[model samples]
Target: MTPSDASPWNSPGTVRQLGKMLFDHNPTLKINPSVIPSIVGWGLRFLANSTYERHKANMISNIRIARLSLEALRSIRQTAHLNYDQTTRGTMRVFPRGGRMTEFVQMCREMKQWGVQFEVLDQNQILEKEPCLGAVIDRYVGAVFFPDDESGDAHKFTNEIARLATELGVQLLLNTNILKIVNGSSSRISHLSTSRGDVSADVYVLSLGSYSPILARPLGISLPIIPVKGYSVTVALNGWKGGPTRPVMDDGYHAMMVPMGDRLRMGGRAEFAGYDTRVDEEEGWRVLDDIMKILPVLRSHIDANAVLNWSGLRAMTPGGPPLVGPTSYANLLLNTGHGPLGWTMACGSAKLISDLITHRQV
Candidate 1:
């Protein structure tokens, strides 16, 4: 089977479901809520002037939560294989537009005010940091380096966390289909009617990612969640010395490559293709072509046969923030529409939900 056919997780729907599952069980097994109501999307709107200050605060909060997650993984020896490899290595966000960089510099300043270490770099400085960027340096004007940002295998991280959750008495039912969410009296979640049987919970939190809006429609909750399909290809390093040692985003091409162990994961582009998971071979190659633009030297080193292509649905909200909070139902809560930053904000969202459920101050 080809990589697309061989891997079940390659489908857009599967990845979204897995992401939700990861967050759901990660904190749920500990009796802590795995979903939370949060206004965490404000931080990602770096280009918007109106919310720049709020965005900075959100960025700081996200960084802190990411650090907390790294610390949690560090405490456990089994997580080592998950590549929770903590590094202070910064990420370079390269954009083609030079004039717009001024706004980014101002945003960096705001981030610094919130204690996020960031540096604005010119084209030469961008190439100096990562020579892999030399391929497309001329296509971009400058870049921003978030010194404290991090990257890890979201798949592995989720698996490790889920394993720990299972070991701690969380019952993991894999491949089970949830048909519908049933609401009973007084706008309270009654029970989730699944393919297997009806499972009831005192409190129900929606962590279904792209599927949240679909499931909520029956209950009269209209969520502004759109499934944006994203593609990724994992290219084996195979002793390719020119490979980047850190994550680099080609803002011009809208593609990013993250170094994970011996493999380079290149992910980019958002296609509003509904729930379709089929990846056109030509389109997949196109994504690789974009990767080549950013790392031309590594093109020859990349073993075409060894590349693992994948497509996932990102439940992108209109703005960048997720809709996290109590829905119309008293017992039903929402934790979906996280888009690309779900992994970065997972633990924090989980903790918030747990705190809210227990009546603690959020």
Candidate 2:
């Protein structure tokens, strides 16, 4: 069925937990709320039968989030006139009417309290919005897209955010890993000794991403942060026939094509090979082939083609959603594990983390 009629519980991640619940509680009947997700989901769904509406609301919100994020980047870049962009966070118009293969696994996505529709954009309508994508618009039967999907420069964005945080008197620390945790109990963390030095505060945050667990365990807390390694290739946008545009991701293989300034960020594959953050050809070019396959006009030699290619690690949790709640420790809160949406979720996540630390509810 179309996303319009699809249920949020239709997602595999929630269903897997559901299946586990069905088995864990009893093979025959039902169990308890322990296996279920948030209470709001169960109560609103089971009691009132409002899940479908909620799912549609959430899908629309995703579109708005994608849109707002793209606008933020575009506004920032435009204001600065800096030449930088990325596919992971930006205005990405997926046009099936232009022969572009658009597919992505939306299997385990959570429906937000807000609205964001997952309805496929019509092929004809998308091209009208993005004329430059006319060539690759015809291939897809339908599109599950974030129209405002833009390519983001995380390094640039982080640098900017750090500047803002500094302005807000939020101490910005980088490469300063917390080597040890001193205390945790009654929702309070006492001290954090980083590689640089010991830091004692009324509140401490763990934005350590994938390395969160190593430190969390010592404090009698378990953080479900897993390193999800992904590979990205940056190809130059100069001398390319096709007009540079926003980012694209192949739903079939997690392959993404994102245009940033004068370069294209092609990403593909997610390897669960422990903590190794090495970049190799086989893993890096999984999406490259797809790029050449889809957008042939931009094809060229590896040397002349790409200015830089690299891989980055994303901290993923068991469920795709980020871990953004306070721990048992009042001072220690979790803010990592954003996966692909880290850049998009950064501002919101940081605000939420900030709220948690300050005891703000909304």
| TM-score to native of every candidate shown | 0.76, 0.69
TM-score of 2: 0.69
- Which residue runs of candidate 2 sit more than 4 Å off their true CA positions? 1-10, 13-114, 117-138, 168-170, 184-187, 239-241, 301-307, 360-362
Evaluate candidate 2 by giving its C-alpha RMSD to the native, one decimal.
9.2
Top TM-score prediction, candidate number: 1
The local distance difference test score of each candidate is: 0.65, 0.54
Tens-place lDDT per residue, model 2, 1-362, is 01121232223234434454346421211333443342234233322322445444434533343345445555555655443344432233343343323323242134222233344566665555445456666654555554333446677666775675577797766778778988845556678888899888776777778788888887788766666567777876655536445555444333566666656777655555456677777545555766666665565434543446677767855434567777776567788776556776665566567666677521
Deviation in Å, model 1, residue 293 alpha carbon: 2.0
| Total clashing pairs for each candidate | 4, 40
What is the lDDT, from 0 to 100, of the residue 245 in candidate 2?
A: 59
